[model samples]
Target: MRHGPATRRGRPAVSGRIVLRLDRMMVERGRSLGWLARQVGITDANLSKIKNNHVSAIRFSTLAAICEALDCQPGDVLVYEADDGDDGTGPRP
Candidate 1:
């Protein structure tokens, strides 16, 4: 029997992608990157990475901080896209 791709722990790989809308939320809230970083208790450079979706992972505490600062829910910032055979590098509509 053949097995599907496994993660480091041997569990089957999970598909789909998480898209960060940090920039959008920031604009909607009219808050600058530096201000958000300070409110979230993180560095401006680190926040920029998240805003640009350059990071592979994020901590729950950080997520909570962002949500609190932006007055939004987790779903508002982190959007999950199903794996539909299209490359995720394209800009969102």
Candidate 2:
């Protein structure tokens, strides 16, 4: 059997937390993923995941490394975008 897309009903399941824009900052700094990872003593894959926002959790140690390498504050690396209505699903992109 196959399944079809469900009809939009209640609030959309949108995440109130918008993604962090660390990748952009990294680019602006001309830093490569491998370079940052090496500087911070983390694996390249791990850094890539964080850069892509695929990480669900981060430790204070890791956060501190990133902040130190980038010479920026935690707030400078992340942004909080409040969820606008549409339930949680959010407005149509």
Candidate 3:
């Protein structure tokens, strides 16, 4: 089976990364894990796993549910940080 975001050496991919900002969104929305879980119809434990980036994949349905519950778009909760091929400094685009 295929995996996600892992390189041949089993390290996270260097080119790019997907970040879950669920915890930050929850905090900004003043919502508890348990509460959001209830709203999203998922278990708190599962949500926690996603929040902590322990899981490599998430279903589209789940993502939609979370987006709906948070009253925000996907971009508000997910972020992409380009690695810039090892150079870290750059002016804002």
Candidate 4:
């Protein structure tokens, strides 16, 4: 049977990647978006958007306030993952 879309049979592609562990970080810090919003005086919805990585841009002051309140560095909020293309088996690579 024909499998799903073939991936050029071994060719690899490079793409920029972004990793977000904000949810985990918030849990570890014993803080919620609401609390953070109150602390930073930003809307909870805004914080949620950032937590879900749906935010397109964020002000430096807001980021700085979050970092200060959470006592964590930017690295803790964002992670980097290399782009490894599918090996033609499945999406998991």
Instruction: RMSD for all candidates, in order, please.
Output: 4.6, 8.7, 6.3, 9.1
The model with the greatest lDDT is 1
Better of 1 and 2 by TM-score: 1
Residue pairs in clash, model 3: none
Question: What lDDT tens digits, residue by residue, belong to model 2 across residues 23-85?
Answer: 877888889888899989999998888888898877889888898998888776776566653
Write the residue-wise lDDT of candidate 4 on 26-82 in tens digits.
Answer: 899999889988988888888888889897666778878888999998777776565
Between candidates 1 and 4, which one is better according to lDDT? 1
Comparing 2 with 4 on TM-score, the higher-scoring candidate is 2
Off by over 4 Å in 1: 1-4, 85-93
Best by TM-score: 1
Cα deviation of 32 in candidate 1 (Å)?
A: 0.8
The TM-scores of all predictions, comma-separated, are: 0.79, 0.69, 0.73, 0.67
Candidate 2: which stretches are off by over 4 Å? 1-15, 85-93
In terms of lDDT, the poorest run of 10 residues in model 4 is 84-93
In candidate 4, the residue pairs with backbone N, CA or C atoms under 3 Å apart (3 or more residues apart, or in different chains) clash, namely none
Ranking by TM-score: 1, 3, 2, 4
| lDDT, residue 22, model 3 | 94
Q: After superposition, how far is residue 11 of candidate 1 from its true place, in Å?
A: 1.7
